[model samples]
Target: MASNQASNNTQQESKFTLSMNHDMEQQQICLDHQQVEEKEFDYSKRSQWLRAAVLGANDGLVSTASLMMGIGAVKKDIKVMILTGFAGLVAGACSMAIGEFVSVYSQLDIEVAQMKRDNKRSNKIKGNNEDEKNVLPNPAQAAAASALAFSVGAIVPLLAASFIRDYKVRIGAVVAAVTIALMVFGWLGAVLGKAPAIKSSARVLFGGWLAMAITYGLTKLIGSSGL
Candidate 1:
């Protein structure tokens, strides 16, 4: 009977050890699964339009606001301010679209030309297939993106200062609206582009404020000079 009890104890201990090993394996598998689920972020995909989008919006906000502030400072007429703002918005949007299209198309053309040259040389040697399959930028897509972003951003100040009748109030409204919108744009750009948020926001905000101030100051000076 004593020997039988000892044998039973040995079997129980063996069973416990096996169970513990099984549980440990399961825990390790769970950890591996969790690690697989957490993936590193890839920024290459976002980089394509991230730059154009940020630039488009920044240009729209700054250009439109500066134009409005410059004109509004010298002349208090709402019509003049609105008309100038509208003109800037339209012209700026078109310019951005055209600029993006031309710029991207030119770059793509150059790259294609270079690739063709490379392919010719490569074919003369042993031939390379990698360059042929390289992805190039789409000019239409870039133009559309820039135009849309610029238009959206440009409208903020126009809409903000449109209703105000007071000259000073309208200018203030434009400045306030532009500064706030620029900060938001910067933050959005940073978040989407995976950059530092505060730095981006502050940089955009400062640029916009400086633009308005300079525009206002220059226009005021010119107005004071009576020419």
Candidate 2:
């Protein structure tokens, strides 16, 4: 009888041990799932900012380079080309900042309105919820980031043509530098957004080249025509 009792106790302990192990396994799975979800959310936020930066940089680089190329085609003076590029950089940066500010402000208003509606419908107090506030976009921050990115991109062509004295060489340098920067920006954007790197790079590179070519060709034609 005592032996039977001992065996029953052993069975109970074994079952308890199995149950604890199962619970632990379930907890581990839940934890891993939560971690994965958090990681993906973080990545999504990162991708958004990276994409914005890439767009701003690409705009700055292409516009400034095209302006320089156009001026070079007509004037052939390094000072004129540099000045044109600088003007374009400043104007583009300010434009980007203002545009981004307005766009994001509109978006922020829409989101805040939606959040307020949701809270009202759910009978929740409209408190200063940190989580809700954190998710909202800041117009000032967006504007600053956009301006900074545009300035950074616009400087590339300016620097590339700064030292070259020969008009032809300066144009070539600007083109080469803009091409490389476009490719890099495309690749970085693709990597962050999980897109095809080669395709993105090629598209950006060709677009930049086309813009510069068109600007140069048109300016040259106009200058030659004395129009």
Candidate 3:
């Protein structure tokens, strides 16, 4: 009876050990699944759009504002400033759109060509199994984003100038408006890209100020020279 009891205990321990191991494996699998799901959830993936949009907007704000301010220094006429600003807005937007489209399309073409070469090389070898590589870049979408962003940035300074009468006041308003818009844009870009907002905002603001100041100074020098 004692020997039978010992055998029964041994069987029970074996069964318990197997059951515990099975439970542990199930728990491990569950944990792995959860980890994979969590990894797939990412908020920073929107940087692709933010990258192009922010750059376009920054260029629009700085370039259009600088142009108008340069002309404003020499000519205080509101119509001239408005006309110059409007022309810059249109030209800059078009340029940005075309440039972005071409650049993105060129990159896409190169990638496609490389992918084809890789596919050919892979097929020449025996018993090689590689995942198919496909890449598509939307040039139209990028162009549209750039154009729209440029218009948005350019309109702010123009609107500010339109409301003011004095050249000095207009210049001040344009500078202030561009600076604030740039700061906001930089902050928004930083937030979207998961970067430091303060640093980004400060850098963009300074760059914009320097651009407008330099342009205004040059125009003043030229004006004084009667050129």
Candidate 4:
């Protein structure tokens, strides 16, 4: 009888241990799922800053180079060319900053307005609304993006002027730099904007080239007129 009682006690202990082990396994699975969800939601602000910095440096190099080239093409004096380059760098950086800020702010405003509209629509159609919250760009993200864009746009030209020597080479370098930067920016915009990469890249490139061309033509005409 004692042996039988001992066997029954052993069976109960085994069942209890098995149940505890199962619970532990279930808990571990839950923890893993939670970790994965957190990982999936992660976004890095530093990465955006790094991208902007690279873009800014590139912009600085290109714009300064282009201005120097255009001026050098007209004016043979090294002093005049350098001075013009310096001026262009400062002006370009400021222009880039302001332009970026304004453009980003405008977009941000539009997005906010859009989100508000969406919310109202969602409320009106409660049953039909299928988690539209995931579709909108976070406000924080837009702000970060804007800040990065402006910062990069402003800093590059200024730094480029400091490094480059030959006015014409600087100009060529600037053109190359700007072209590359535009391409990169386009890609970035497309990724962030969640749009077609090729289309976005083309748009950015076109705008950049148009600005450069206008500047080049105007400067040339003015230089030729002896003005």
Among all candidates shown, the one with the greatest TM-score: 2
Runs with alpha carbons beyond 4 Å of true place in candidate 4? 44-53, 69-78, 118-227
**Model 1 spans with C-alpha error above 4 angstroms:** 1-41, 121-134
TM-score of each: 0.76, 0.89, 0.79, 0.47
Please provide, for model 1 over 1-227, each residue's C-alpha lDDT reduced to its tens digit, 9 standing for 90 to 100: 99999999999999999999999999999998877665322466667778888899889889999998899878889999999999999999999999999999999899888877877776743334554545788899889999998988899999998899988787778888887899899999999887899999999899989998999899999999998
Q: Where does candidate 3 clash, by residue pair?
A: none
* Candidate 2 segments exceeding 4 Å error: 126-131
Give lDDT: candidate 3, residue 184: 98
Candidate 3 ranges beyond 4 A from true positions? 1-45, 123-135
The candidate 3 region of ten consecutive residues with least summed lDDT is 126-135
lDDT of 2 at 21: 100
For all candidates, the clash counts are: 0, 0, 0, 6
Q: In candidate 3, what are the lDDT values of residues 1-227, reduced to their tens digit?
A: 99999999999999999999999999999999998776545544566777888998999999999999999989999999999999999999999999989998997789778867876877644333233332367788888999999999999889999978887889889988998999999999998777899999999999999999999999999999986
Model 4 residue 47 CA deviation (Å) reads 5.4
lDDT of 4 by residue, 7-39 (tens): 999999999999999999999999999998765
lDDT of 1 at 13: 100
Each prediction's Cα RMSD?
5.7, 2.1, 4.6, 8.4
Residues 7-91 of candidate 2: C-alpha lDDT, one tens digit per residue: 9999999999999999999999999999999989988989889978998999999999999999888898888888999999999
Q: How well does candidate 2 score on lDDT at residue 7?
A: 100
> What's the distance in Å from true for residue 139, model 2?
1.2
